[model samples]
Target: MRSPLLGVWERLRQGSTSFLVDASLGALLAGWAVVDTLAEPALAPAACLPAAVASGSVALRTRAPMAMAVLASVGFLGYGLAPGTSTPLWSFVTILVVAFAVGAQLRGRRRWAAMSVLLLVTYAVQILDAHRSPGELTWGEVFLTPAVLVLGPALAGWLLQRARRQAVDLRRLAAELETERGRYAAAAAEAERSRIARELHDVISHSVSVMVVQAGAAEQLLPPGSPAREQIRAVRNTGKEALAELRRQLGLLGTGGDPAPLPGLDDLPQLARATGATLTSEGVPAGDTSPGLGLTAYRVVQEALTNASRYAAGASVRIRVVHRGDELELDVANDAGRPADQRGSGRGLAGMRERVELYGGSLDAGPREGGWRVHAWLPRRSGSPR
Candidate 1:
């Protein structure tokens, strides 16, 4: 029951037009007051004018509610004690409406003070008016009049204002709850990513260390220039490279950034040779480049060559880097080789694409001319913000 009443009150608070509700209310009360004046043979139509002024000013209740309430109360009492006029029911009703408006619209200490003054002033006026006519006066009627006129509507309006404040607080709390939920979810995802990075670092580092040790033992046991010693040397070199990569990954997981300087174009030849690929370049300089761009370029070549080594082992691979004015381009192509039974996690290619796209670049990787190709174009400009 309480909820339904609150909903109704909320609907009424929503505006229709400029004072449409207030103006309609004022007009109705004025008409009723005029009717009451006409019914009283002693009261003239001129008496209706003051009542209309008092009631109609309620249209400005939201703008000046205290003034409206005071005007209505004064007009109702003053005219009630006029030379030959009687108080009308509509006049008292207008007083009630204006009193409620004062409580609902006025904020802070001013509202309570205005309400108290209205009650006190109305009480004094009623008593003075009754004292002028000796036989018609009663204590109960005087007290009841002020209580009914001031307390009822004012309390109702104050209660409504409190409810409106509570509704606003509830909405703010809900928004805060949603924000907290999103923050918690993000934190959880980051923690999980770090956990996976740590696990990979531990497992891969231990495995690579064991393989390097075994390869070194084999190379030492074999006679110099033996065919098997060369293979063992290659295995040891690959294990060392894998260990370096594992350290880099560990640094990223622990510190959230690369602690060591990233490999750039200079390392491309070694990267290509490790994967048995031929490295070539055109128009690119051997000097310094942007850290972000260089890191992205290195990763692109690394991921492509890694993919070729895993999925197309013993294949003929080619890597090319080109430096066009305002752009850097990369291409890695590999002919089909012995098919591997296992596939990758797909994260390496995705990470490469993400890195390229971060610099407003483009990447394309797919089958082309009986071989797999990965191509990327990254932007470069002097004085560009990193």
Candidate 2:
């Protein structure tokens, strides 16, 4: 309700300002004519009335500028023809005002035509008046008055029109900039939400997989005082480890808490052992790799194993990371005999692709032969070999 009321008020204010600007110009011209004409004693009282009325017509100049101009010209002519009327200087002021208004409103050829007609008519009136009076028409008075009266006003109007057009263009450009800003803001917000969702998914999925695996192992090894007691204790330790990691990760997402250190490529071996997946590292030592490359390597393996355990329950998976020149390459493959419908929806693969691409890297994942494969390559640093 408040917004609607404000909109109405803004519209009203704009309309009022436009009206005042247009009407004020008209009123000024009329007032000038009144002051100039009243100064001459030779002009009759009736002649002064037409000159005064011509000034008021300026109020309608913007709306019906051409018509108001015609009206003012006709009034000036009428005043000139009146008996006892001296040279009507005030009449010229109204004609000039009308000439300027016409040029401002009319465009191109029409504007030139209006200006030409105004000059011709005003000069003709001056010439006829001089012919009837005792004074002879001098070149300066004949040419200068009409030029000043018509061209001066027309030039002013043309400039004002140009200024108004530039202002309108500026407003349109500002609106477009504002719209683009809003769209970018919305896109940023959506991206942040997506990152949070991915983080939550990773934490939850990893915790659940560890819990299920340990529970299954404990159940299978449960017996009466057998050597399997050691295996059961191992299961308890695994469960506790999984729970502690889950709590730490979840706390990072809580209010006013610092984020836990992210599990990077260096943590891949621990991740594999925790998930009960037979894992082997065949590349350079993790400590020798850069932090960025290690992080990417870790996330890829983590997402891959999570998907394999969830979808391909009993499948043996092979994970490999290789440092070749200035590029780090990764490949995770699983030969778990599972149908397409049994596999994860590939969101982890998509997230891996996004993460790799941020570092100007490439990723590929698809069904190959009888199994699925995920591969990625990330540049080591600036100016590193591709």
Candidate 3:
């Protein structure tokens, strides 16, 4: 449970403009005097002076607690020895409040020194009063009374300072933790983007170079105006176009760059023909697809075709696409070919899976019926294909 002094310290921390807190303490001291005067009319005059001194100075407790404590302590001690009167209880309470404030507000050796002086004065008063009335009160009562009054508030103030320090430390640590978390997330995202960029470069540069070299060689051998010669020229032109597109896409990473058009399901036919794979489709719509879904679908096909060229070259491959109203599905299967250590670094399939799953899609790839099959599904937006 929280201590009462800690609760008071929290109120002081608020630093309110209105002096309600100080006024309340002053009111409490006056109230005690009024009650005591009603109970003992003969002692009223003697209590009034000390009461005024203690209560009137309470307004400066937070700003000048040490000074207030000294003033209040002296007034309390003087009232106790006043003729025809005992110590005013309210005056003693006010002194404790100031002592607690001193311990709480002051820092380092100053706090300890101030509290030490206050306690010493309190004991001196008790000793002098006891010496005046020898044998009336024992040394134990003299020790215990000052000890309780002096030590209680000081201990409470020390506890309050410690608790406030701990709370500040916890808040600072929490802010640091949040900052680290955001930095880590941004770092991870940048790393992933770089990885994807590298993979695209590898696939495009290798495939397009091969196509260009093969088409040029065929054109050199074929006769002019031949149908096959025209097809060879088309192949060379297509490879150049694809390479230029890939370069434009890479440029998008720079400042003030225009985004390159991403190939989608509509481009699958050309992609499959270029990769020597047969293409088939069902329920595929014809207008613009969402950029995210289209890019994901394009990457899925690209990765699968690149894998086939590596693991199953010269093999017959078939690619199937099915467009549902809310999602798109793709499958690429190829018959086994010359198996020349086609087991990849596994990054290709991992990248493809990452792309598909990013859009709440699923992917599956494994050997099936003496061939390999890659399948994926991606969520689709409600729009016509481009």
Candidate 4:
């Protein structure tokens, strides 16, 4: 998608680049030999047989090198013995490329051994000017020349193969390094956020504690049943509630101490009594519910009760929990009443929403029937990722 050349390259590689290059070279060289054969009267159409074999056999250098070696063995033998004063350099270059391919691409000694024999037979019997008989063939001509010509190109090909392997290994290492770098960045970001949260918690806790103590002192100076005494008492009570909520939230963030377990269905009765809310349930007993669903149920009701106390004090609050086989449903609602203090950061609703979603559930909080309502649907037995 990023580059048009990437698509072209994929097509070329799939077609086998080595086969294409070798086949093209073979066609050009064979065409030259065919033209030379047509020019010479002595070398008729029959002499072009070896040229045809070499042309096609060169294409299989990588796919099937042994097959090419077998065919080239028969083809070059005929070309060497063909009626001519001498052969051209193209014929020898074709043989050299074949020898190099065998050494570089194949895995076993048998292929190289076969190639060595082919080189010897082709060199010894190849058409030459003032041709010598078999007995006149010297040791230097037999071993030394063939060794130099065959080994030189084969060594080059082998070195190229090694360099290709190193390039592939380096690419793999670079990809792994990129993955590790991303993981480290994520860990550092999370640690920084936690550090800021702890700092904020300390500052806010100290300030709120000081306000509660001063309010208590103010109440002591006032007469019993005075209008100012009640206001001071409310300030002290609100500060206590804020501290409790702060501790609950910090506990959820892995504070590394003996943290109390979150309230659940089993503690709903006590929670209702403390908040002056009524609780009703259906379908399943508290002990039969999964811990994750029960915990979510308790939190939803606790948040709804806190909201009612803030905005609709002395109102009728009701908590309902129902188990419908595969799912658990919760609904908390309050009747319209007097508006009390309107102070909140609104984090309780956000926290309850996120906590429910972490268990793959949903929370719906909004106004209903002139009062606020929070309804949540949670799947039974699903674990919380938090």
- Which prediction has the highest lDDT against the true structure? 1
TM-score of each: 0.54, 0.52, 0.55, 0.51
For model 4, residues 211-283, the per-residue Cα lDDT tens digits are 8999999999999989999899999999999988877776666554433354577898999999988988888
Model 3 misplaced regions, further than 4 Å: 1-14, 34-47, 77-82, 131-135, 211-386
Per-candidate total of colliding backbone pairs: 0, 3, 6, 0
Off by over 4 Å in 2: 1-41, 83-89, 105-113, 133-136, 199-204, 223-283, 286-386
- Which is better, 3 or 4, measured by TM-score? 3
TM-score of 2: 0.52
* Ten residues in sequence with the least summed lDDT for candidate 2: 253-262
* Tens-digit per-residue lDDT, 1-386, candidate 2: 47998998887687777668768876777677667776768666677677766677777666666667666767766766676664555565567668778878877877887787778767877777676765676767877888888998899999999999999999999999999999999888766655564454354445456566776677676786777777766776776677667656655544234344556666777887787766555555433444445666778778878777776777778887776666778888888556434645557888888878866789998887777888888876632112
Instruction: Give the C-alpha lDDT of model 1.
Output: 0.77
Give all candidates' CA lDDT scores. Answer: 0.77, 0.71, 0.75, 0.74
RMSD of each: 18.4, 15.2, 14.3, 20.7
Off by over 4 Å in 1: 1-18, 128-134, 220-237, 247-386
Q: What would the per-residue lDDT of candidate 3 be over residues 1-386, giving only the tens digit for each residue?
A: 99999989888767655367776776777677556745775665756676566555566667676667666666666565555454456656766776787767777887877787778767877787787678987999988987788789888988898899999999999999999999998888776665556446554555577779999999999988889998889999999998888767765643124333557666888998888889988995635565456667888999998888888877899999987778788999999887655567789999899888777788999998978999998766532222
Q: Report lDDT (Cα) of residue 331, candidate 2.
A: 85
lDDT of 1 at 386: 29
